[model samples]
Structures are given as structure tokens and as C-alpha cells.
Target: MDIHGTIKIDELKKPYFVWFEENWIHDDVLHHHQKGQLVYVESGFQYITIEEKIYLLPQNHAVWIPPNAVHKTNSHSEKIKLMIMFADISTQESFYYEVNVFSVPPVLKEMIKYAEKWSKQMTVNHNENLFLKALFNELPQFVEHSLTLHISLPKDKRLAKVIQHLHNHYRNEIKMEDLSDTAHLSFRTLERIFKKETGLTLSKYQQMLRIIKSLEYLSSGNLTISETAYEVGYKSVQAYTRSFQSVMQFRPTDFIKTIQ
Candidate 1:
């Protein structure tokens, strides 16, 4: 898919701040912008693909997408409430070029909410400018709370096909040998290439997909623990819990409690 584009910010004035609340269902084309972007998920989960790696942003968390970074997004839930903001590139010196996910502090969260309300009611003014300045100033401190759970993709076309297949069939029982056949490579070669390109074995990559997907299922609050386990292809709840804890550093129950 030729899903690539750029977002121009020449129309936006300096010290610019914009907020949007969206419920995205379809996947967006990969694109980049000259201005930095901040995305905060207030309710549901979002899957962001950046540099061939997919990062899952669950509720109550935010991601900073620096200027000129190619990225795409897929919403995993209905009514996925997101607060998207754009800032001028010259406003901050410590802005990162890489995507980073961090916990949203209550103070910053309220600031964003207030900005959203204010933006809807009026245009940017002196008071709003001060809010934007303070928001940008406090953003750098939250970078230390970055969380990483990235599933890397390979550049090789054959391996890329295999990875896509696994992503589509993650909830099903998939064998490495079968994947090798799909990629038209020997099982050993498939294993080697997968590790070399993605720094993860095929099994581990599959596990990461499952765990990340489970976050969406659990966040919905409609599935029981056992149901979620089975939904993610885990035959047993214990196995699912182990994988969840290993990837998320917390049990599924505890995670649900926090998000709730």
C-alpha cells in the first residue's frame, strides 16, 4: 500500500495548539508532519505503527510523535476517545524525533482537557498562549515515564509477508514451519532472518502480538479474564496471565483495575 503523506503546518501561526477528539475505526495512511503531535487516549486503545514497529497506547496514556516521523494508527475499540494536539517545531528544544509513550499525569491531563474546551469556545489569545507555554514546559518532564512494548517488522518482502500473516492470524495456532513455507524459506532460514531483522524470534513476536492485543480485549471491560485468555489464543487463563504480566509488568486483573 502506498500509504505515505506529509502534513503541512504553514497555515498555523506560531505558538499554535489544536486539540481534537475522534473515534477512529479505520487504519490511517502512514504520514508525517512538520509540527510535533501529542496523542492522549482518554478511553479506548490505539495501535500506532512507527518505523515498522507497532506501539499499543491504552487508556490514560499518551504518546509524543516528533516532527517528520512517519506513523500510522489503528483504533482497537469503539468510541476511542483521543486528544490530539499539534505544536510548532520551534517552540521546544528537547522534543524528541522518536515516538515515546508515557503515563499522563493528572495535572497535564486536566490542562489538555481545559485546552480542548477553550479551543472550542474561542480562538487563541494571551491567556491561551500562557497555557500552551506551560503545557509544553511540563511535557519534557514526563518523558522519563516512557514505556516500550514494540513489535518490530522486517524489511524483507518475504519476511514482511510472513509477519503480516501472523498479525492477521495471531489468535490462531500458527507453526513456525508453516510460516516458513508461506515465506518460501526453510524453517532454519526463517528463524534466522526473523531474529536478524526484528531482534525477536518468531515465537516471541507472536507472543508480543497476543499480549498487546489482549490489552484491547481487557480494556473493553466486556470480557471476563477467562474469555479474554481464550480470545487471545491462550488455551488457559494462567498462560494468558503469565504472558500479560511478562509484557506489561502487571497482572491482567491489576491492569483492568487501574484503567477502570
Candidate 2:
């Protein structure tokens, strides 16, 4: 959804704007706006590129885009549902300065969905405006308490191939030798370069990718915990729970409850 068309969001007189889009498809063109933006995913995942870095936005999560930050979002799936907000209020807090992707608590998610009634603008000093302000005020606390499930992509061609291999084979057992061969580098060289490019160890990055994939499985509502764990390459539910908690700060069962 590009706000750069004839209807510029910054020109609106309201202090806040909210839009809930269903089965949405984005233009994927790089664009930015004057007001800070918050995008929450109700279903399906979105890939958001900010400043040349791509972040994964899974279901039941939200991403914050700072004011005037060049960003673009894309989703190949046609079932994506998004709750978007444009806020004109001043936010000098550190978290508001850069893009962040964090899990949305059930309460905050409900509050945001409740705002679907008012789309573009809400009258000032009215109940709708007050409700939206309360919802926005509650976001920072949730962000502080929740872990940001950071999933980023590499730009280097060799590393990009390695990343693709990992993405395609995350459900199976992959070894360092295989990854090294995929990258066409020595094991040690691949390790050093992968860490340097992604700021994450290869093992950690792979585990994060697996867990993110597992989120997709669980959100579908057709998989049991054991089924989802097995789909993500976990030999046992215990191991899967540990890895999921390490990345999400919550257990798989807890996340399932959120979706239910």
C-alpha cells in the first residue's frame, strides 16, 4: 500500500490513521512517509525491506517503521492480512528511531483489530481517537517485553546461495561441510564470512530460520505441536521447545494458545 499517491497521509489533519487490509498484495516499490508507521500481521508472513536489509514478519507479529524511512513490503501469498497505522505524534524513544519486528501480545492485537472501524482518520477529542491513543501507548511496553525474532538476508552472491540452500533444506539435517560446498568456500572461510555478513553465527542463523518456519506451520491450525516440531527438523518436542524459546522467549504451546 503506497501512500505516495494523490492522497498523501501526512496531509491528513488527524493525529492517527488505521487501516486493516485483507488478502492484501503490496507494490514492493521502495517508499517512505512523514509519519511513523506500524504494521501488524494477522495472517500469513510479510517480507519488509528497510535500508537494504530484509526482515521477516510472521503471523501474530508487528513491525515498526520510523518516520520517513525508505521501506517496502512484499508477500507472495494472497491470504495476507495486515493492520496498518500512521502516527503523527512525536516519539523520541529509542525504539522509534529504527525498524523493529516484535511479537504482539494478545491484548494489543485485539486492541488493534478493534480499531478496524475507523480507517483513515479519527476525529480529535472523540472516543475513537482516545481508544487509538491508548492502543499506541501500549505498544512500547509490549515491544520491551517481547523478543524481536530477527530474521535477515545476506546480499553477497555466495552467501545468498548458502542462505537459499538453508531455506530450502532447513527441515533436513545440514552439515557445515555441505554449507561450505554450497558457498564454494572452505569451512572456516564460510563461517567467518557468514558471521561477518549476517552478524549471526551460521548455526544460530539456521536455528532462527527453522523456528520462523515453524511459526508458519503452527499458525496454519492444521498441525499439532509434534507435527510442527517435526516439520522444522526437531528430533524431539523438547529440543524444539528449547530452540523456539531461545528465539521467541516463549514456548511453542504458548504461541499456539495465542493463535487459538
Candidate 3:
């Protein structure tokens, strides 16, 4: 998927820089940089893989990549618009040390949009740099809006088989003993390895995967809320809504409004 052979910018040496990319299409190879990156999807979506986990960045959301974090990304939508900011963070707070995906608040969204006008390396005392500093300082407060949308793939070969099976049958009922048999491990051993590798229990991981897949289904506009709930394996709309709210921190109707 080399729609663009390479989109290059000298971001590593610059203290701060901004790049506005429209309809970006690249399946980037695994790479890392010394600068922290903030990629906001103005429209469409992008998928980022970090530490064997896949994170979906939908419209009106952003993903923060800490300096030196190993990852790769790809976006399929021709309508995609991205505002990417790179900053040197040697003296920054500890908050910038982690990877996160969160909904872009209205204020931060506007700030990022406004930042599109300046597309080159910024000097320390430049007016744009001051605004960028302010944006970074206020980001910790917004981290509370982080979403639980990442899907983890275990490194263990046997556990990975179970994860693949879960993804293929997420819309149907699953049994633990069945997964254990498929993994060729005892039930307790299978669960233990899975939890250790993914940091989530099997049930919790399944619930999260269902909710993440439902986002794509809901955004496609062919399914109503109740239909989407049932499509993702929920027995009732109320149960689905509860799970959605727990993971996304918003109701399904509210999310629909943002995309529409």
C-alpha cells in the first residue's frame, strides 16, 4: 500500500514543527523517532500499531506517540485529513512519556485546526511556539478523555491463536474451555498467559473488542443503535449501551452526533 512512496519531513532535528496532511495513504514500516508526535485525525481514520496492539484513530480523535516509541501506521480513507505535530520533549512532564488515544476536546480541536496554517519548523520564541507550549501544558487535563479502543495481540504463539479466534468470532458466544482447547493449553494456563501478555482478562478483552468493532459498524450508517448493539453480540440494547459508555465515556447517540 505505497500510495505515497515516502512523505518526508525533517522533524527529528527541529524543536517543534507542524504538518498538515490530506488524504495520506501509506502503510509505514515499523519506525521510531526522538520527537514526540501528536497526530489528530481531522476526518476519516488511521490505524496505529504499537507493541503488538492495534489502535484505531477515528474522526475527531488524536493519538499521542511518546518519543522513541516503536510503532507503524496506515490509513485507507482518501478523505483523511491529519494534523501532525512533532516536538522535542526532553524536559517535559512525565505525562508525555506514555502513548494515549483520546477524543479531541472542542478547544483543543480548534487549536489544532488553527495550527495548520503554520507548516514549518518553529523557533523557540515564535508566537506559534508559545501557543504550542500552551497546548501541551493543558493536555494533561484532557487525558481523562482517553478511550479504551486498543486491541491487543499477544506475543505468545499459542495465545495469539486464541486472540485470532476471538477476533473472528467476536459477534458470537464463546466458551473459555473451547478457547483453551484451541490454544492447546489448560484453561488456567491459557487465561494466565493471555492476561500476562495483554494485561486484560479474557472476558474484558472480548468485551473491548466487541465495542471497538461496533464503532466501525455504527460509523458506516447502515445500522441503527439497537441493530448495532445486537450485531456486536449484545443480547439487549441496555447491556450494549452500558459497555459502550464504560469504554468510550459517551453514549452511542452522542458518538454518532460527532461523526455526523
Candidate 4:
């Protein structure tokens, strides 16, 4: 797929910067990225959906998306933000997805502005890298608003095990018995608890996840419909097509072509 590529401004020796001043959500955006991304709202508000979790970011906060993850963006038409995308993660690898409500410290603020300037100027001096490194070191996360996953997301042991297993293997038929094993409960008990916790049936959640992955693939435009179906673990194209159509109101090929 011809990606309506993010307006990237990366220097070979410096950071990649993006500054969206206004309703970037209305502008064309394709898939997410292959490198870590830091999205900080300098002004106005924006809503982001990542890994089935949602975050509403206002000024003074930022959200991070690890490489290759499925993410969606929502912006108020007046929203203005500057995003810094990089191949490098300044914090520990484990902290990559843990970013939320990061208080933009004085140092981090200017560094971001310098990067934005460079994004427009198309150049950065050697000393810029040192300042950039220092800024990322202590970008404080806001304590007041509670850096939360919007939907009271639980760390249910049952859900955790089921997720890992499906992630490792979503190609097989989604069997209630198998899911029950992951949850260490009888199928009936597991279903009841899963529904209560996530507000979605086990089957529905699994389907949603598959569809999200499928859309990411569709963004590439390179995968044939059959290839994408199997890639996301659908055993057959017809079954995958049905699911995609039911959820997204479009077949894979048609979606790709429409986006292209």
C-alpha cells in the first residue's frame, strides 16, 4: 500500500521529529511504525488507542508506541502536538510501553522544540544529540491524573495466560476448552469472569485483536488478501474475509484499494 507516510523529519545523525499543529487525525495516516514513537501534546487534547487500551492526553503529557504495535490516534481539531519518533529508546527496554502523562520538564520541552526546529530546518549540530539524550533521561510522568489505561484494564491471570497463548498461536480454532486451560478454570467459569472483567466475550475480544492485526497488515498494501488472512492466523481466506467484513464493513482487497 502506498502509505500516506507520516511527515517524517529524521536526520541520519539526529532524532526524527514530527510536529502536527491542528487536526492531524483528519490528515491521511497509514500504519504505525517500526521504531519507538513519543507523542507529546504541547497544546490541546488528543485521544490515542493502543494495544486495545485507550489514553486521553492533554497538554503536559505524552504517549509512547513501541515499534510495530497497532495504534490509532484521535485529535481535537484544535489539537497541536509535537511527536518525536526514533529508532532508539532512551529508557530501559522494559519501560518502552510504560509511558503516560509524562510531565514535560523544562529541559525536555526545549529539546523537543529544538528537534521540531530541526524538523523544519533540516539540520542539527553535533551538540544537539547530547542535549536530546539528557532531556529523555528524566521526562517526568504526571502524578495527578493517574497514568491509567482508560478501561479499568485488569491484570487478570486468566486473561493474561490466554493472551500469551493466543499471541503465540492465533492460527488455530479459538476453542473454549483451550482458553479455559489458559485461565485454569472450567469453560463456564472462565467465560463468566472474562465477560465481567473485559466487558466483552472471550470470542469477541479475540476477533477484535485479529482484526486489528489484519488492518496493520492491510496498511502495507503489499500483502495479498489470502496472505494477510493466514498471516493473522485465519486458516482460510473466506473465513477471514467474513470476519473482516463483519467488523470493518469492507473486504481486505477492497479496503486496501480504497486506502491506496
Candidate with top lDDT is 3
In Å, residue 94's CA in model 2 sits off its true spot by 1.0
Quickly count the clashes in candidate 3.
Answer: 0
Q: If scored against the real structure, what TM-score would every candidate get?
A: 0.86, 0.84, 0.87, 0.48
Q: Model 3: runs farther than 4 Å from truth?
A: 1-12, 74-78, 120-125, 220-222, 257-260
RMSD of 4: 14.1
Candidate with more favorable, higher TM-score: 1 or 4: 1
> Compared with the true structure, what per-residue lDDT tens digits does model 2 show for residues 1-260?
35535456766778788877777666769888788899998887777887766677777878888888988875534588888988865868777777777778878887888888886553554777788788777777878654455566677788988888887887888886778887889999998988888888888888988887787778777789899999889999999999999888889888777655
**lDDT at residue 67 of model 1 (Cα atoms):** 79
Residue 153 CA error for candidate 2 (Å)?
A: 1.7
Candidate 3 has its poorest 10 consecutive residues by lDDT at: 1-10
Worst 10 residues of 2 by lDDT: 1-10
For candidate 3, the lDDT comes to 0.79
RMSD to the true structure for each prediction, in A, is: 3.4, 2.9, 3.0, 14.1
Pairwise lDDT winner, candidates 1 and 4 = 1
Candidate number achieving the greatest TM-score relative to the actual structure? 3
Q: Please write out the lDDT profile of model 3 over residues 6-39, one tens digit for every residue.
A: 4343333456778787766555787776777898
Q: How accurate is candidate 2 locally (lDDT)?
A: 0.78
Q: All models: lDDT? A: 0.77, 0.78, 0.79, 0.58
| Per-residue accuracy of model 4 over 1-260 as CA lDDT, tens digit each | 11225344232444543443443443334355555667766655565666666555545456666765666664442545545435455455455555454445555666677666444334555665565555554443322232432432335765788766665666557676778876779988987887887776777767766775665455444577889899888889999999988865667776555333
- lDDT per residue for candidate 1 within 1-260, as digits (tens), equals 21222223434555555656566444487876676778888898888887778888888888898877788885567688887777666654655566788768777888888888644323457777788777877788866656655788788888978988989999999877888888899999999989999998998888989987887777777889899899989999999998888877778887676566
Runs of candidate 2 with Cα error greater than 4 angstroms are 1-7, 10-13, 52-54, 76-78, 122-131
How far is 117's C-alpha from truth in model 3 (Å)? 1.3
* Candidate 4 Cα misplacement greater than 4 A, ranges: 1-15, 18-30, 75-79, 83-87, 90-92, 120-125, 140-146, 152-260
